[model samples]
Target: MARGLVGFREQAENQAKFFVSRGIPIYASVLTTALEMIAAGEGHVPSVLEEAWKDREFSSPYERALLLCASMRFEALRDSSHPLAEKIGDDADGQGRVTREELDRAIDFGRTLDSLVRRFVQTNEVSRSITWQLAATCFEGDGPIVVIDLGTSAGATLVGDRIAQNWQAADGSPIVLGEEKRARKRYGLDRRPVDLADSDQEGWLRACIWPGQRDRVLRFRRAVEEVKKAKAAGELVVSKMGAEDMVAFVRQIANENPGARILVAETAFIDYLPPDIRAPFEKDLGDFISAHPGRAVWSGLEDALAPVTEGGGKRFPAEIRLRRASRMHVVARCEWHPSVVAIDHAELAKARTPH
Candidate 1:
């Protein structure tokens, strides 16, 4: 467990630097301080780090633990009596420096390791840009479009198409998305789907947001409200299913609506899949596309452009691929959250190569 925590600490430091580069200094500070506490292995660090080590298959233990700590800080920022509340308030600019004493006090006041263990980080920002791009790409298709979201916790991304959001290109040109509401059906598949109406679930969702990111927090709140409205109207359907089941469901939907374009979308998913599962999952998707040509598309915003093999390796230039009939085209290489997108029209125009 200590060894694992060491690995997690290293990953956390990298994540802290990454967030700092992305202008989320609050997250960087939180994660950096969290790393210090974990390295010390004292004062709530053991309890918090212990919870993170439970799942050996967990993809981002450092990130999960950091978010848990940030959630505690967020709660502290909300309360007046908390010792670190004022010091660690929700001011992104104010996250200049966090002392060890403040971190210890905050953790002691907000010790909920069990809740942290049960929760998963499922941010909806990645879906914002993805939905817009999908709308632009498939809005002109023959029939109504069907969207299937894998790892769709709380069904947030499933309803992304209906939400009103704006995005700009790297060149500062406003990227216009298709306004047509052609998404006839939306399905969310998760092994354990979160109930948006449940207060505990809602709290966990809010806790997943990074500390001091007011815009992201506000966007998430709005997304929750939108999801609630959709659920009340019976427009969003969530199933107790995994990625394999989701693929089968997509096939079923395609068969039922032959003319409809079936789009399988996943954001920050796929990386968690074990190598064994990931390989077969890709094969299954490829077979499905081969069996039904020009009828289905897979759009994914994952940590990597391609799935990681048994021997792990790092690749550069993050890209979004639109796969159709077993052919993939690199549409754009986007930032981590895809807020800034650089379209690769030349690469997209090239013949569909093996993905």
Candidate 2:
């Protein structure tokens, strides 16, 4: 909860544990380790994390750490060099400890991180589009579809079905795939739209990812090229829009193509919304579907939205809900980079989620 909600000190500790639990490289733990060191109030490490801990300008403490690390990483590259050129090409594991130089650089960089955190810290976890594929399974229309990703970054996941995916269970058994292949029109709505063609902006997105996951990094790069190809084809476009306008956007599209089905989705989007605004935003799509039936469905993939047990691990389900049908079902619980999955086809077929 600290990851989504708040608790600066506890958020730091839990986020560190989360990275370790996710099998993220040991190098990523530097965020927590430095905070612990800074608690001493004096030394080579500057005590700057304290100021941002309780601040309410941004989302969670975990995001604060991401912003801090990303800002610092880029700040180190002011000398006209790729920040991750070596890390991307190298296959070596990050050693199990944070270095003194890392601490020194982080300290120097921390002073400038607050402004960036407030302005430019958002994740475009394109891999989370597995949920979009699952959600697409909800509407059975074959007359093409509309997919609007609210947390769109470079709109990578907008081309999900086009991307090769391997879905499996904990024991590595293949799961039955859904019919979420291809979309007629895909529009990504985001407050800050990223242009993958821009190296500097793209580098910042790369920096947000935790270190030492070479496979994830490679997959993202490939996805970037795919998105570029998609842009050329004009099948996908990311609009500079906010989630607040999602209802109106869908309505506008529906007016354009009354026969086409629409799926409004959010992957880890609610975590960044202010507390007062979360409730209205959470149910806006659902309410929209209720008011105007059959054309639109809501799909939400967030950590705290729905939790279920699968593959002997705590997992968050990519849930699909249809108001008119009074049915809802979870397609799967997608883990990191989500080349793997755990889905119950029987449950999905039965629409186990009660309306």
Highest TM-score, which number?
Answer: 1
Query: Per-residue alpha-carbon lDDT of model 2 for 134-178, expressed as tens digits?
Result: 766656647677887887877877765665556567578865454
Which of the numbered candidates is closest to the native, going by highest lDDT?
1
Worst 10 residues of 2 by lDDT: 80-89
lDDT (Cα atoms) of all candidates against the true structure: 0.63, 0.61
User: TM-score for every candidate vs. truth?
Assistant: 0.81, 0.79
Pairs in clash, predicted candidate 2:
none
Query: What's the lDDT for residue 168 in model 1?
Result: 54
